[model samples]
Target: MMSKKLWEGSKQFKEHSHLHDYKLWLATSKGLKFKNYQELWQWSVTEVEDFWESMWNYFNVISHKPYSKVLSSHQMPDCKWFEGATINYAEHLFRKAKDNETAIIFGNEAGINQDISWLELKTKVASLATYFKSIGVTKGDRVVAFLPNIPEATIAFLAVNSIGAIWSSTSPDFGSESVVDRFAQIEPKVLIAVDGYQYNGKPYDKSNIVNAIVDALPTLKKVLVLPYLNTNALDNFPKHYENINHIFNTVSGELTFEPVAFNHPIWVLYSSGTTGLPKAIVHSHGGILLEHLKYMAFHNDVHEGERFFWFSTTGWMMWNFVQAAFLMGASIVLYDGSPTYPNFNALWKFSEDVKIAHFGTSAPYLVACMKKGLMPKAEFDLYSIRSISSTGAPLPPEAFDYVYANIKDDVWLCSMAGGTDVCTAFVGGVPEYAVHSGEIQCRALGVSLYAYDDHGNPVEDQLGEMVIDKPMPSMPIYFWNDTDNKRYKASYFEHYPGKWRHGDFIRINSKTNGLVIYGRSDATLNRHGIRIGTSEIYRAVNKIKAVEDSLIVNLELEEGKHYMPLFVKMKNSAKLTDEVKSQINNQLKKEYSPRHVPDEIIQVDDIPYTISGKKMEAPIKKILLGMSLEKSINFDSMRNPESVQFFIEFATQI
Candidate 1:
């Protein structure tokens, strides 16, 4: 069935974790005793208010004012955490910086860039924040950035947060319109952007895209551009633009912090825009601050001054999450280019060179390494890697085997599953536990997650909907521009009526007491380990006159393989030619990225729809995965009853 013990924590490993220290403090200070992790976890979720308050006290959260209440309401869509508390998230990042030898390590695909010291980082952040204030950027004002995974992105984010202004960002690779769709909704006052970026050893010049994006956002007051690729990047712009270098050149002002409420919005992270537009999900400063502290120290088991790196772009949530390593006083590593530039050994080589302690990446990257059969342990010296974390997709059991056998024998592999909806991991690793194959070590403390069946009943040891019965602090404050919290409630609470339905299929094995996530339960496209919405794809596909209608689905097969096929309905018996396919692929790439291009294009009679006139993507996804036709579709609820049979026959052939 499964291989024996992938990895186990030694006695030293258990004692070295933050969990050990916290438990000791609990017993000494609060007189709380627990036999094992489950007992501790039980106390965490059961007594939610007391548990979170302990986290606040244990971590010693520096607040401008004391909280009147730990939690105002326990219900979803209304939980006001740490109400009446005033705190600044950026204040904590500097607590470990006084011993500042180095705060951040920067690297590119080819080699290491410059290492930024904590003093330098503080200076730049102060300078930028001063510049922002001079330009009228105030608290709660949105400042958006279009950049890559670089030191500037981190600096800008910290600067924005330090001044109590809101922050939002996406990768520079996004098409101009796609960027507009998300940023326009927020009505950001300032635009921070890069001219271009390098990926897979090739340079992408986005000077025109930046100009186009700026043109679309009428609310933008001032545009500051980074000459990342060409020095004359701003020369081509139609209007005058401020050089981003001005702030760096000037000596910074006195670094200051603005005290805001605990529930004040820190940053806006985007969803896949699956329905219409990308949901601008907002996370509070204190919520993320608390969550990140717990996750980085306890779950990841990272010590201060250790080098932490996760391969991520500015667009992804992990990029934001990676910054939390600062809360642990860890040196965060930012690598800008493709993970597999010269070869698959690119990131691995960088890890060895940088001596990264916490190596964070996606499951797909690990699977690729397994397929290539590249022995990283043999090829490079990865002795500094204390732990490895994978997210954005499920890590197959075989990939777990590969890590122990081929990468590092004793290294801890923490395969966690969470989304942009929550900036922190819902279920992740516990340093005190054994590393079981294909199982997340534990559900995060203070998160009440359970596998629920369709009838809203919690089920054990069976695949069911991932639901959270208790409110987490890191849950969204509200969607940007959402009126009366309507969209926010519908996105999460509508499914189960008060309980958050996370749209992920998961099962908790009774034997291991660990979680096994089966990927998203909905129609969101899981390509390249990132969730993409169908609306973005359909927007590009619709431009083709030959295609009248279309539907796209991502099928998660065995061996960590993903099959995404786009079924197109031709217009008026029009032919589906090679030219049409090329047009579709190019448009998607131009609009989004290469990941948006589907693997296969097949002609279909029509696309399926529900009785409410919404695209019936979830049912088609189940049918193509070989579920029985009767279970996959109900004729009474669909707009077209007979359209689904073609997919049923087609599934057998594939």
Candidate 2:
């Protein structure tokens, strides 16, 4: 049973008057019938076929060709969903009427507010589609975007999807090598980018990097610049490059769209190649549409006309997830600058201004806000916010408490966890579930997620691997350039046959019926034959007020023995005094075992992170072992790549 006090205090557990009105209809709805989450989960697995079929009908999935069958069988890997169904992904999203209802809200650190209503967004998308069609872009063609989270980027994405063209994007912050590494594999015919971008009150010109990428990728036929900063020289195009206006001028008014099969590829998302070259994970139109709608409507409790905001770039999968809100006719709020630009409460102020219903961000952003002593409860009237969802990393228990105490006591704190491998989440929150301190509420409705021991058997109350036992709608259709699915299989299925090993070390607490994410299984440290998670060490070390962030890794000694070594990154105002180091050691020894204590605690300036703001552990490990850093994937925005060299020197000397 859930704690009564916890249940009553959580906004998720409170009665939703909207759901109450739809309860009777939901109970008797054509494809949906469930009294509780458990019933839906059980029916989804036991009667898997009927469950998804019903979900499709309930969401009013617009398919040109009706599905011959809902599912093929109960097989984990081979199960097929909505076989023979034909649907246009864009058709479902443009369901909103041509009215003045706000569809997109764009903001930045420079105090820019650009709002696009449903009718205006439609017009822009149609104009862009006309442009693409004029340029001979037809069905199955690919268009690449290296742009920010501006309105133009969203318009480009919608236009490509509308005309059945595949869309792929990465943020402008990525270096030329990283951008080329990804777009080269896709062989995109058209490239869309901005002249420059602004972050933290500084402008960055992309002419050099963009020109390099455009020249290297021979398949790129055209370059369309959005003109963010550089706009004086009009005709600045290479031999094969053409400006966006030049292409738009030749666009005809006539638009032709082709509907495709349900499994047709819509977008290609790249995995964070911390270890190697990033893998291009492709997602289908129909599956992504259906699954995102389910997540937005039921899981997020998003209603039509509600305002939704997620602080993410086009590179992250959350950007795609946020764009899906338009399918429900909800207005999306977008920001394209540093969250702490000018002030720490930039996002909070935007939320208050937009009256956002659902606010999504990263764990580091919240932790930074906490460290800055930001209290939204005192300054902003964020009553409109019903849910706050966090991803990119596991939410610390203290962060959860900080949000409830300082942001809104009654708001739902959702710690959603999934990756680019699957466009949607495996474990997330539901509107009716009770929010725990540090637990993702439940497995996604139709997603089969469980903790498995080394023997591949399900386990509880202990740390183990998190695996999805069955395939869901949003599983990647295929990998780019992987002709025989070899790369796809090796990426996800090599660890366990026919099962997705999600690479998370999680412990399910039987007492509270919650989950505690220890850390990544690949990054798990082993000393004296005992496996330990990096988060255990982090949780103890970060508790010290002097430490801002830290990275823990296993260092192999000369005798081939392994010991835990931690690298601490202190704040600008703090120092790594001997007293603080001793305190860290004492805390670790008291909270955990002596083995959990680090052999050395060295302070650094900044921890290296990926473009999506995740700590780059594998690369640091490679650096310590004196290996090549070239193979370290996604090194575009490493905070301090040179610091790895110093770490290696220090390790050798020690």
Candidate 3:
């Protein structure tokens, strides 16, 4: 099949592109000509220091102290950026704000929509920051949040960062065990939590979970609870616990942004915990600030006053990205509860109603909408939307077609792939370039992405391990509680010994210079010594009208034999007939390879997914390999934990 260009950059879009402006500036100041995005990307990867220095200036990053050097050294793990510079993350987010402009728009599954003006948001953050200082919070102190995707979570994070205190957060849906496993490692001094939260029109009381977490964390000096679900929920808790209103009402002060070193940790992000206990990946104040500004302004092409919305919980990294929209002077749209509470069109209708300019969500949501044949263009007035981004999984080519054909033909659809390690996309959308179906427009500026074969040599147009030859500004400063940097090294550098191995299977198209991600390399299928990406199989299986979703795992059996099984979730009226199986096999053989066909195709009730909507492939593979459920995955991190039982039962029969 031939690839189609979905959208072309208009003159207005080119004028708004931060990258385009930078290109013009480069030609005028540095006497360098970058005629296209490809030439600009080549220079960016070749002269890394110059590119980053230019980015720092282009974003107009506010710094209290000048850096002694642009880069201290070229070491992978020890690369120091902007040495001696001091800055505060919250300062950039709240700067250049108009009092009357909207800063945050909150929406819930129950049709609750509210907006907070810039002045109101600033006032709330100032009050919380003052209260935090009164409670002995200071630089390097940890403040953990177990809250929903409400305005309070954003305020708490800003307040924590405003004082140079490190912030960490997880969704309220996580159980006490999962929450403690993450927050306990950091030894936070303050615990910000919700009394309860609502999802899919059902209220869940999280008071007990918060109590358990507070009881387990000995370093917690104070507990602040928000009345999220039920207003009276906090009354049942102990009197020692503080109410959110008490802090907001008694404090009155201007927010002070404490300037710390560029490398000073700002927040701790946890891994998926599919293999073992979650790794607390810590990011710095200046590193995250500069990175997010570039990612949001240039890659997303976010203009001031544009409405940016991404359906995410506080647990996901995208929520942190959404917070960065304020840095670009853009209004953030926050949504809590299910994206499809009433129906699959809930988000589409809401996006139209609110006139969201830039919308972000996962590939699974788009794929489900495509399979159900939901015509969003016919139902909703989405002319206000300029771009839509999909992540969390590889977007099937069919989903790409569905978006242009059924959603909007003129809109830009970006299928980006990045992980929690860097908290940004290595390959993402570039508004200045044409978007091809099922491909990321370009490698993000300043990110040195290369696909490496087994011998550690770079290759083009062939799927291989995705690796970074240089350190990104947003790479984790360090892992919390990881002394001697042993765990951090083992996680990324162990495979290649020096470079950053991102653990994803990917290829860069030679013709279009676009990125096509296969699934995670760890979950790739290897049959008869031939490796195949899971996306190749998924593309074929998901094309069948009957299949709703699918999963495949390669198992090593007795006598060095192998068995590759494919589990499929079918539609209600569809059956896994022999003709259907034959069609799938034939499609795989013709499109991918003869080896792409699985040994057995089994029907399953549902596919397991993380709370962030990623297919739980690695965790399921571990469970099918004889590992117990508790050891494979944390149940609290799953959207439907019961779906894991199907794999465990299938493992027994094998």
Candidate 4:
């Protein structure tokens, strides 16, 4: 099956793809016919309501108030989508606002690249939705931010979803106790923050963590701020402050669009959970506008004046999945510091000075640029990179032969995985398949993904539990104050009742039909009875170039004792020696077995991630199984809460 294809797509380049003009508009509108892309993803998940009413009539969706049907209750926590749709996810990203095009392209760590236009992004989102309706704000209210991937955080999240409010954000390097444990569970009412942030070249002012998240958000009522890195930051705020550049130069008006109600609440996105208080989730505004117009026209083909770029952080979910490259009129490129600041070829020279064309990142930043053997195609001009993707984790297949041997043998590496519970990707990249090395090149179109087995059936290439049986128009329409749905039915339908397990650990590769994942099935790694998958010990410790990062876990003691361990994090003065623990136990006993090595190898000066970089493996296996480190993690949602005090002092010597 995997005849090692690495790149493919040609029937005259898949007939100038947009998924081949959406399979010739579903064969001249629904006469249908699909002899590939797995029969158009099995008729898009077995006719999920005539494939979401033909994706609201092949994306001409401008419904001011239409959807009265097209799925109501098909299962999982009582499904309901498109019920009386009133649309307006920021009027479909300014529905073709083409004034001087280039809508957003920033950059930071003071490398500088700026640009904004679409008539200065629709006049700064109509002067921040006329200063959020002159301070009273409205429709669903909330609002949030502490902001960073700038263009004033996508012009204040398209002016707080163009007035039907409710947005959320975090990244001012979090910590005001993780931005008041997720904007004090969404009781926001406008905060917009940021008088800080520089990173890797250091600045970090955060006016006392924005004056302690404006004195721990007492249902805020306007705060604004934004003098990025202190210009006497409105002389230090907190008495109901203001200034966000004087309300974007004196609040102009008329950028209206509040049609809402297609499952309203537009953003919230949290859940990098290492300990409680994070799952605010939410997502709607027509389930992320039909899942970002079907994930940017079928798993990111994202064309129209394309520029894209996704080295995210306005607290990750790929910055709301790179604003789905403004739903295909593309452009989006933001940066805001540290993609290895002034090093690791700063985002391949910011994707060769911004001719990006769908770059997106993370899979441990392509395994730390393939363990620093960095070539990035001999330093730049990546031929306007068409596709490079790689989502949060589980990529390791030698970072897919280091991107076709040093970052670009005609790119297209993808390697995706979905998270933030469906902010997109349920398996990724589908320009009509064939980019094999580490898999994941399909399964997205209407994602009814499988790989179940542990008795929940649906198997395929073994290693299971990554369910999802249908229901996805970007999943979460709940979570904010999660009550009656009881933490959204224990976060993903209590295991397998109606499906959607999604705590990772996938497989389904039947030789490149694609999808491999292998990570978080709640940090699984049984050992002697075999269960593994910490990306199979990070693809055998990312083939040990003096292992610069690693984590592994296991634990499960008593009567069938397991333990495991590993840890690593070496590089610089590279000492983990004993010949690097016998070359990491003979590369996990020659690539997987010897029960995939371990039972303690330790070195650790780093590891514990999650400020969206993830890999805090179920909070370090709930702190080496004795739990309690404030009940296993959440040191302000940690990026390195001091690399978690050497795993809480090696969890009290095991």
Candidate 5:
């Protein structure tokens, strides 16, 4: 049993203790009052219908067509949410129109700040909407963007959604082939591009690549170029392409918004596709908008006029999530350059300057900050920050400690877990919960999550496959161009019969009432029929000094048996010596079983990652197995793909 002191001290648990109107409705509407997290979770699975129905009502999700039924049946694969409901995703997001409120604050490593008020944002979106309508762009038409995470990108997204047109985008850094691989498949009617982008004190000219991609895609009707960098290259721009100003000039009258069905496609977000071509995960208008609001209002506790900043690119799902803040009348902060370009304190400086309330970033960014040994508490006055959210990967326990000790004493460290597939979090913070050490506070409200053992039974206080037993409103409507739902089923439902397998190896701690996400299940290492998470080895290895980061892979022997091999990347001015390798081995053997010790340990200069900043483990595994390196789906932000050849050479030698 959890101690009373721990529960009360928890920021999340204490906030929900009082019986608010919403809380009362959730408790009685679904009979969800439980003695503990376990009881509430178990009851949620059994009473899936009541749980979701109550959640929709509790959140006050506006719908044109009321849901005739909450769920279809007990079938996991076929489970549906808000059945027969019709709603406009953009309308819900724009519900907050209170005058002159700050809607967006854009920044960069060069210390540039661009603030946009709600009224200004609305005007720009309306103008963009008028342009789209005048150009024969209508509902269901695909509008693709290859832009940075600037205010214009967010405006374009809202404009596309406002007119019921489907929007898809990638960061400007994506190569021509990678961009072509995705946008070509969708046959987008309109393409949005920027001339160039600035990153890490360098200017990258994407106009050439953008011109090349537009030349290849025959289905593209028109290309709209935004004058980025204030360069006079507009004349040098492609003759076939039209300037953004020209498109808006054609739009003359008041904007007219056409509301579509609840499941209308809003955006087509592609997977990294390191192994093959990327999968286009299509999210619905209602699902993305409503789920984001749920997370923003309830999970992040974002109040009106608060400043929100998340360092992300247009390629990342966080960019999409951050744009939703405009709907809440919050100031959405956007940064375009490297987080540590001029100094390690760039982001901190921006936070202080903007007086941000909610700050979101990747775990690696925090880990990198900790590695630099720079303390923000001493450098800057960060009294404005109330919450700090970390995602992209499992936050190391040491980073958690570093944050609490240096960033803020009373701020909530919300370690969120979800993927681009859903466009929102499945497990994250609720204001009424406590922040646990190295754990996400709680499963998202209304998301029926469970940890199931191999026997398909729910497990408690143990590591198991993370699955959602019931459907939620945020579940993807379908895969793009997948008429038969074949790709959708194969992606999520093929692992488990009916349940939504989230593909994470996680453990729910009954003692602390928190969750520990070990790593991705596909990346799980198998030794002597025992499945162990790779993060288990990382946790042990990262604890050692001189080791900045590490990656572990399971190598198959001649007999088809797998053995574990480890790779380490040392800190700057540090090397992985024999002593360091021995120390890592000793720690692994002592903490885990003897079998957990890797067969070999090698050092590498750097690790390859997806555009979204996840370590590309599957490609490394393929390289170790002597397989061809398949083209990456989103290669724009991918750094150092050639480094994998070093791993391949080391694998052959071993």
Candidate 6:
């Protein structure tokens, strides 16, 4: 049975909502009348062209050239949106900046507190842009960063986008090899990094990692290192490093916007790379500008001068989403440390101290707090917080109740599901919509998301593949290096041909029209909302001379409950020992990330594979979750057909 609505908007909230503003504008201009969010959504999906054009025009997108057509083609991977339109992504963001208004508010576990005004932010971005131009960096050049979630990272991203240079970033927490694996593919011209960052109240110096990455990337012509922790960090690094402070101090100028086509690449994001190398998914300037404007202004209800904060590392896509706050002239709140450092109340305290209006985090964080019995409502004064957003995983029904009963009764708790692919949520928060317990309010406007059965039949109120029938502005322009579009088509289009299979198991409530995400249908581990590829784990384990082969699977035991155990096929000469386990753990932490390290390590005689010698990660994942063996895998297709019995028996023991 489905849960009841947990929270509803007040009369004041409804009348003043950005959604209401959009409705009024549409009704006055387009003569579109919608009584509710459902009616509006119906019109949005059915009249796709009008809905997107309305969104584009409603945001008053500052395009230098008008689009010839809304969508040139409707085919997936071949969809060309906003054709002939020329725009710069950073232009819209800077246009909203105010001289006296605060642009950024930052705090960290180390008790660092600082704020950057809009004027200072613009000046910093301008300075960085000038420096990049001096070094021959121009449009379409890749500028990558390995930095913490600091103001400088945001500035660097803004400056890169201002000059029409594509930007990509990863958290400093990523292992050196993992960082290299991602940045090397893009062949960046300039690399921005930090000396160190604080997490869990401990300072971690990243000079060694930065040095190694710089050495690995021969394509880098310049390296700018920020002295985040150590002021003399640049002197310690063994490279021709330029101090970020020197560039800011020496360079001063106004930013010059570089206009490009609507489909011009703005940023290059990466896939989980479970099967192979991470696919460099590229997104365009115009598409992202329009999508974010709609998402922030309408869906998130972010108003000018309001404070918006989302707990994210540079590695996650949320960091990119947070930048849109600037486009709306809202102050962005950034924290560069563990949420639970010193105590679990740290995040709530930060919110209270900064007076955040919109606070966002992952489902696991809320579940951890609930389990630990840390009641923020009873302890902290979160008076200014209006909305709390949850993503990365499904929010348990219990979690929804806990948020209202223990956190804030009046606040809206929005649980959404979208991923790195779109850089936006497919189903997310709608300020005017009633939030049902454990369900996303509604599908995002301009997104045609629905569940489909294996035979391509659409289903509601039942689990199936979460498929998007129509393309949105934010879908990846293309996978970098995918010239023939073979890899891109196989990734999404192969499942349904025309529709995009997002590879998530989900269901939409027939009555409430809210979404419930079960988990990933693929082998990627989405633990703590971070997507870690299975092959990344294999890369670390394979390096161990004693290990023969390995299989890693993340099983969703229940909502917000997961068990990721590493199964190993060890060499006959090498036995499973404490030392070997420690080595594997250390290597995984060192090479991939701490998130990918398994909760348990178990020895197996053999690892299952297909006749084509491909690792059967999806089948093994299903077997461990107690799914029927016959339905999970075909015996004739497996090279080691008898090997399936081992996991089937093991599932029963667990």
Q: Which candidate is the best by lDDT?
A: 3
Cα misplacement distance, residue 629 of candidate 1 (Å) = 24
Best by TM-score: 3
TM, every model: 0.82, 0.94, 0.98, 0.34, 0.93, 0.82
Local distance difference test scores for all models: 0.86, 0.79, 0.88, 0.82, 0.78, 0.85
In angstroms, the error of model 1 at 241 is: 0.9
lDDT tens digits, residue span 211-276, model 1: 889889999999999888888887876556888887689747878989899999999998754334
**lDDT tens per residue, model 5, 1-654:** 342221123544345432233455567865556654445556655776775555567657778778777767666445566667877777766777654867788888777887788777777788888888878999999999999998889888889988899999999877888788788878999999998888889888876888898888898888889888655647767677777766555554454457777777888998886676678888887667667766787677777778888999998889988977765667788889888888888999889998999999998899888777778988889999988999998987778888878877778788889998888888887555567667787887667787989887878777899998777666777777787888888888988867799899888777665788888988888888788888778778877878888888897778777767788889884777999988999999998888889988888887778777898776787677776545322344466666666776775765
The TM-score measured for candidate 5 stands at: 0.93
Q: After superposition, how far is residue 242 of candidate 5 from its true place, in Å?
A: 2.3
Better of 3 and 5 by TM-score: 3
Superposition error at 216 for model 4 (Å): 26
Clashes of each: 0, 0, 0, 0, 8, 0
Two-way TM-score contest, 2 vs 4, winner: 2
Cα distance off (Å), candidate 6, residue 60 = 1.1
Model 2, stretches more than 4 Å misplaced? Answer: 1-26, 29-35, 74-78, 233-235, 239-242, 245-257, 511-513, 556-560, 637-640
lDDT of 4 by residue, 1-654 (tens): 453677886676567778889888999977898888888888889988888788888888898878878888778767888798788887888776689878888878678888888888888788888878877898898888888888888888888888898888878887888788888888887788888888899887888888887788888877888888877887777556887788778778777787988888888888875687778888788878887888788777787888888888888787987876777787889888889876878888888887887788888888888888898888788898878888888887778877888888877777778888778888888877788787777788888888887788888877988888879877887887777878887878787877778888788876567878888888888776668788887788878888888888888877877788888889885678788788888888887778888877889788888777887878878887887777777888877889888787778988
The global Cα lDDT (0 to 1) of model 6 is 0.85
For every candidate in turn, the CA RMSD to the true structure comes to 10.6, 2.5, 1.4, 22.5, 2.8, 10.6
Error of 2 at 562 (Å): 1.1
Model with the higher TM-score, candidate 5 or 6: 5
TM-score for model 3?
0.98
Candidate 2: TM-score?
A: 0.94
How many Å off is the CA of 17 in candidate 3?
1.5
